[model samples]
Structures are given as C-alpha cells and as structure tokens.
Target: MIEYGFRLPSSHDNRPLKFEEFERHLDKTILVSATPGKYDYEKTDKKNIVEQVIRPTGLVDPIVEIQETKGQIDDLIKRLNVVIKNGHRGLITTLTKNSAEKLTEFLVEANFKVKYLHSDIDTLERIDILRDLRLGVIDVIVGINLLREGLDLPEVAFIGILDADKQGFLRSTTALIQTIGRAARNVEGYVVMYADKITDAMAAALSETERRRNIQIAHNLKHGITPQSIVKAVKDIAQHRSTKLKGGKKSDATKVPKEERLRLLAEMEAQMDLASQNFEFEKAAELRDEIERLQAEWGL
Candidate 1:
C-alpha cells in the first residue's frame, strides 16, 4: 500500500491517527513524504529508506528569492499581475485568517480575481474554491496553513509567503518547504519570501530547496531533458460522479419547481447523512456533490 501524506497520521493534529495502528495491520507499506519526521526514520531500516530527489518530468524545484517586507503588499500585487499576465496562477500564504481575508479584499479592490481560504470556510466550499482556481475562474488564492500540503495546482507559477521571518509552527522549516513545493509543478515555478531578516527556518528552507533544485537541474542536463509544465485534466465533481440521486434514480433538476427542488435537496441531504453513518463514503460524496450542483444550477 502507498501511504501518501504519511505525516498527517503521525502529526499532532486535532484527531491524529496512531501510526502504529497502520503498522499493525498492513504487512507491507510504503510511507511517502518530502519531509518525513523522526518517527518515520526510526521505523524504517537504513537500507529500506528510498529517496526520490529527482522528478521524472525533469521539473526543477522553484527558484526561491527573499525580498524586504517593506511595502510587501504593493510588491506582491505587482508580482501577481505579472504572473497573471503570463497566464499562470499565484498563491499567497499569510500568518492568520484575518490577514488572508484582508489581503484578498485589497486585491479585489485592485481589480484582481482573488479569493481567500481558511479554516473558517466550510470544507465543501474550500473544495469549490480550489476547483475554481484550477478551472481559471480565479487567478489568485490567499490562504493560511491549508495551502501547505496535498494541493496539486499545475497552473500555479508563483507563490508569495508573507511574514516568512515569523517564528512559529506556520513559518517553520517544514511548513515553508511544503508551501514552496506548491509552485514546483510548473516549468516557470518561482517562490518569493517577504522578510526583512532571514530566520533560521527560512535559511534552512532556502538551503534545502536549492539543494533539491541543483540535483534536478543536473539530472535534466545529463539526460538532455526539457522541463514541461504538468498538464492535468480538471475534472468537475458532476463529471466524475453521476448526478443521479440515491437509488440510481435520475431527476431533471431544471424541470423541478423551486419548492420541489428545496424538498429534494433536503431529501438528498438526509440520504447523504445515512450514507455517512453506514460508512458508504463514496455514495455520500456523490450525493453531497449533486446537492451542491443543484444549489448552484437552481440558485437555491
């Protein structure tokens, strides 16, 4: 079994899973991460440790640059405008949810298509926001913490990390590396950390990124490979899963009256709950997406 995001289960999150539990059940497992923790190293043998430093696509890690925090917002706006003009997206990571929201507002006032994502936003809505970014509905996303891991946005070319010198979990070496990795999918990947002084975390993150980048560059040169931006098909929820309600029955949402649509929505929501309790997550997700689609299409 391939255990991607192996750090989450071992992390000290709100409801962190016991990594030992997976060890107990799975006879053979492969743990994957860019920055594995101490426990992962201790659990595996030296011979078993596999390092995948070079990407198969020959895409090098982003070029990391540090800029002064003075007039950082204005600088970021100028940089984002250039990124958008090149038909690419940008990501900004702030320290807090309020900072993210305020920056998003300022960008909107500057006539940029931007949105903010934080823990306060509903989970489903966050998924929709990310889909919008992928589908080119939005050009920039300002977020905190949530943008660090498990995000695959190949269209993104620039990432601006605000307050990189801040000493905290959010600005730690691991966190900085993960955020910087967001821009790694594109050929023109680049990252800028706005900080007046370089903290230890920032220094380490920059060094490590440069190391990985050198390795990738050497590999590409040896093979005479040209890096290409990752091209992934953006799949909508409705396209991936059928819009038919539970029990495999299809309903034409357009024909339904407003009052009837509301009732149907409620029914589907209840069915979704039941599916959840029954541990039928795939069905529950299908129903949830269908509900969202109907709400958007019908303007419910």
Candidate 2:
C-alpha cells in the first residue's frame, strides 16, 4: 500500500520506495500501477490481498455510479442531481478531448451548469474555469488528460469516468487511478464508470482500487480515531535540482520503441568505433558503456 501518488515504475526498479513505510507496499508492480513493488503479476499473491484488514476513515464509502454513451447522459444527470441536492460539485473524465467536448456541450444544452478543461484551453481560461467551478458557477467539469492528475476538488462529490473500458495509455490503470483520486477529496464522494466490457486494464485498475481502499480502512481501524482524507503529495521532479534534465535536444519519439531502440544502439556502436579510430577514447568509452547498459536492460 504505497501512499496514493503519481508514480511510474522504471525498468530496473531496485531502488527503495521513499514513501512512508507504514503504507503497505505491493507484491507486484507494472509500469504505472497504483499498487506497489517492482515485480509483475506472476510474482504477486492474490491470497495476500484477501487477508488485508481494513480501518475506517471518517469519509463514507462513496456510491459508485455509471454512465456510458451520449444517450446515457441522462444517467449522469441523475447522478449529478443527487450530488447537487447534497450541495456537492462533480468532475467528469473522458477518453479524449473530442469526447470531453461533446459531453460538455451536451451537459450545457441540457441546462446543467458545466465547463470543460483540456489541453486545447488556454492557461487563463483554465484558471478561470477552475475558479468558476470552485465558486459554484459550474456544477460539473469535463476533462481529458489534464484533470486526471494534480486536481483536488473537495466539493466534488461525484467523479464520473465516461469510458470505463477503452484501452490505451491514457485509459490504462494509472490514468484511471488519478481520475478516481479526484473524488477522494470529499468525505462523501462517489465514482461512476461507464463501459460494456471490463478490460484487463480495468481489471488492473479495480484491483489497485480495492488494494488501496483496504489499506486505508485497516489503518483507521487500528488507530481507534477516525482518519481524515490522506493525500499523497506527488513528487514534483522540478523540486529536486538533480532531477532536471540537462540541456539536450528533445526527441520527438516518445517511447524508445523496440525497433528504434535497437537502431539507436547500432548507431551508437558504429559511432563508438569511429570515435576510437579518431583517438577519442573518452567518447568511445562513454558510448561503449551506454551500449552495454542497454544490452543488460534488454537481458540480451
């Protein structure tokens, strides 16, 4: 049970977690799981999860809701109506900016006070949108990639995930964890997921949710006193001077796709050979070390 935070496991995950030790660590972890540890699923024990004891936080177990298509917007409306009656605000996440826009448009036309936040919106507008949401001018907000992380809306009693089964990096376990986290701010927050199939990604997402929820509950049980909402302050790499990237050209290619990673390795080896011929031992040695490390990472 690692504290709730934004973490992406790296290739050689040998480093010790720096988070609070009391938060139970996970048995297996993948690239971006809300769970803990460095191993993958095979190494994890399902029985260990069953044995997990729970403690109560003052917050209630939020009612889970679900809403799917453009036609199912009414389901969302009913959910929202329940929250509004309780004087709660709401947040909604979509798979893409286009989807978010359509939902926002539909919600507004329905005469429900709403707004949207996505990459397309300018910074000032984002600030204004957030302000309006906080002030109660906008009862609901729709977002794609932006609001999933670093968003804390205490009044948001409802957090709706518009597409529960679309599978991709943005729809993966990590993103779903963040979207769900938005509702963790309120004591009575609820979450809704709308989809036809439960994807492997969704399976992973749900597993992590149950894992963390169980941990938090157990912690409260032992303490005797009710626990308040515990937020994991996310690591801001900008804070640590050493974490900043040194000056270099940015690569357009996001991941080192296997094909490209191999090509780059070959190119580096050739360049290293050339450097050795030119008596550039320093650069040659550096490239040699780089190639060796990459080979080890691939277990080749």
Top lDDT prediction, candidate number: 1
List model 1 lDDT by residue over 122-229, tens digit each.
445666777798888999999887555667899999999999999999999988998889899999989999999999999999999999999999999999999998
C-alpha-based local distance difference test score of model 2: 0.66
Off by over 4 Å in 2: 1-71, 227-300
Give each prediction's root-mean-square deviation over alpha carbons. Answer: 10.2, 16.4
Q: Name the best candidate (by TM-score).
A: 1
Candidate 1 overall lDDT versus native: 0.84
RMSD of 2: 16.4
* Lowest lDDT 10-residue stretch of candidate 1: 242-251
